[model samples]
Target: MEKYPLKDFMDASEPIIVEDVLAHPRVSEIAHTLIASGLRSFAMVPIAVGERWFGVIALGRNEPSTLTREFIRSHRTLAGQAATALESMRLLENTRRRAEREQLTSEITARIRETLDVETVLKTAVHEIGHRLGLAALDVRLGVDKDLLTAQSETKIVEREKEQ
Candidate 1:
């Protein structure tokens, strides 16, 4: 029943079935609603990606004893497919982010090598890195070994030490 505590069922990695929701001790609050809806049985199968549980797939029917061994086996197959799909999507997202980061690094390095003007190189680096990383702001230090260190941002530049 809807009022039944899900913690007990969800904690297990195996499939669980409640053949008669109205007869369950924890479903007293929602027994009336369950009867009204003609829901007699329900089953839940946990979906996990790697070692963590992502969610559950629930099956409900009007028959009092619908969730049998065969039904549970079928639900397990479905749950496995769902977990595989989720893992594939996660891998794809991670691959995309890594590719983007690599491209950003290469572009910045190329730009720096192509320019000898320190101001132009710094500005290009800030703009390219910010747009690639989707950042609101960033700061880069220039002349780290010199007495005068300058910090550059997308909008402005500040000198941190006395100018040479």
Candidate 2:
């Protein structure tokens, strides 16, 4: 469409009523096309999210008619309601995503705390993460070097001797 005046109105987050498309200064440029399309009169209301313009709702008629003050007020009220609904939906979607992430985090934490065995921890971690990500396969390589293993074993032995 006709972008000359409608676009400007939307950008400004305002309402516009054109009684005569041909005589209106803002829409005069596209008056011919508007008349050809059987749109002699039209009113547009902007849908804004907060201070920013999100979209617009327009009503058009083939017969030229004067737009009453009450009619414009009603259309503006409808647009405001639409904006509120959209914002609420966006917030709800965000909350849903955040809840999912929190649930996953809790599950992972519970799995890790379930056992002190390193092998069990690694297996459970990989399985949980892979399942959440929908991965076909997941491989976890635990590289416990020989020297580290020997040190750990020696430490365990010393602790056992002290206990005895």
Candidate 3:
């Protein structure tokens, strides 16, 4: 039915049901909502990560009808595949970010080793550190003074200064 009832039922609950839908009021409500939403018919299957119901996979049809056993089974299979693919993509993205961070660290370390001057070293270290960790506003307190100062660093350059 527009997938709202199925979605709502999942949001409001944690049960996974795939059998008869017309036998229950909640199921009927889903149908009504679907119809009101301009969908003539829909099939809903509860989606879950293990025993918990996460949501539903609903397919809409213009003409009211029911799905065959094979069709329901096939859609459920597709839903499972989609969920797995989504999880895989999330994992891949996380891995890519970690790799990028590590690569940045390596590159920064190499740059520091290639330079000998203290000023260049400090500047390079700070810049690379910020780059690998993230772009940020940094106040570098060097030497024994540790003098308080506001340093807004973008890349290797500081845009504003407030010494304290």
Candidate 4:
């Protein structure tokens, strides 16, 4: 498989047109395998957009000399169209996911602002986030320290006394 003629074309990003699979020097090693698969001639066109190659469009013929130049040209066109369609679909999907994420953020922010209570805010945030992401379970932990709170409270008291 590593030494197969198709692998070379895939790496080279070049179209392969073998008129006779068995007699072709490049495909002689894999001729038996091709014959077993009932292929006398084969062609592969790279489905690529610029330097980004998605894959290959392969066609096999039972009779040699059947894969003509015109046929390969048509196959190349098909491969290009396939690549464009696939790239467009990928871009559309990405845009959809980004829109969903932005909508989820807006919803969570609105719900959080509707309440002043810390517990309500936390619960609303967690629930909205978990539900939006389709999570089985979600948890939030607050690591508030007693010492830190006491120090902060004392500082506030001192500031208030100074202001008064």
Q: Each candidate: what lDDT?
A: 0.73, 0.73, 0.60, 0.72
Least lDDT summed over 10 consecutive residues: which range in candidate 4?
Answer: 151-160
Candidate 1: regions farther than 4 A off = 1-8, 25-38, 115-121, 141-147, 151-164
User: After TM-score superposition, what is the CA distance of residue 89 in candidate 4 from its true location, in Å?
Assistant: 1.0
Pairwise lDDT winner, candidates 1 and 4: 1
Colliding residue pairs in candidate 1: none
- Can you give the lDDT of residue 91 in candidate 3? 75
For model 4, how does the per-residue alpha-carbon lDDT over 8-59 read when each residue is reduced to its tens digit?
A: 6464346888889877898888889899999998888888777766778878
- Provide the lowest-lDDT 10-residue window in model 1: 1-10
Model 2 is weakest, by summed lDDT over 10 consecutive residues, at: 153-162
**TM-score per candidate, chains pooled:** 0.70, 0.70, 0.60, 0.74
Over 4 Å off in model 2, which ranges?
1-5, 51-54, 138-164
Q: Is candidate 3 or candidate 4 better by TM-score?
A: 4
For residues 43-146, could you state the per-residue lDDT of candidate 2 as single tens digits? 88888776756678888999889988999999899999998898888889999999999999899989889999765676677778778877766655444443
User: In model 3, what lDDT does residue 33 have?
Assistant: 60
